[model samples]
Target: MKSLWLSQAGLDTLDNTVALCPNCHRKMHSLNLEEDIIKLRDKVKNYNYK
Candidate 1:
């Protein structure tokens, strides 16, 4: 249960949130890098469109 953006602003907004599985969520926080998150986001977007 972590905020992907690591920001308090718009925290309750659906568009600002991502529902990640526990393992993935933990990994994300551990990585703790915006670039990594953005890369993952692009990958998911590309995957979904394919």
Candidate 2:
């Protein structure tokens, strides 16, 4: 699995509750908004590294 990070669209929806990597945030803007949400959900569910 790949390391998961927050996207720009995700950050927008988060309403300033989270920090984002600049490059990831920029790339996220190029992706479909809906797809970003879906990817975020999947990333959360699979977030078990801790």
Candidate 3:
């Protein structure tokens, strides 16, 4: 099985470590999550789930 580690924006581990999804074996360097909450709300209004 693989494992993952996340280094928080700090110096030490006991107070600055973040645990990520263990299956991913590497540290997450960066994330590019766009805040599309408004777009999603509008899209869901017109989307048919069936």
Best by TM-score: 1
The local lDDT score (0 to 100) that residue 1 gets in candidate 3 is: 22
Candidate 2, residues 1-50, lDDT tens digits: the string is 43333442333344233344886666665664777757766776686756
Candidate No. with top lDDT: 1
Q: Model 1 off-target regions past 4 Å?
A: 1-10, 43-50
Query: For model 3, how does the per-residue alpha-carbon lDDT over 1-50 read when each residue is reduced to its tens digit?
Result: 21223333345554334334653223234432234333434565686758
Pick by TM-score: 1 or 2, better one? 1
* Cα distance off (Å), candidate 3, residue 35: 6.0
Candidate 3: residue 12 Cα off by (Å): 35
Better of 1 and 2 by lDDT: 1
TM-score of 1: 0.51
lDDT-sorted candidate list, best first: 1, 2, 3
User: Model 1 scores what on Cα lDDT?
Assistant: 0.67
Pairwise lDDT winner, candidates 1 and 3: 1
Model 1 clash pairs? none
Question: Model 2 clash pairs?
Answer: none
Task: Give a tens-digit lDDT track for model 1, residues 10-38.
Answer: 46676566678998888887877778777
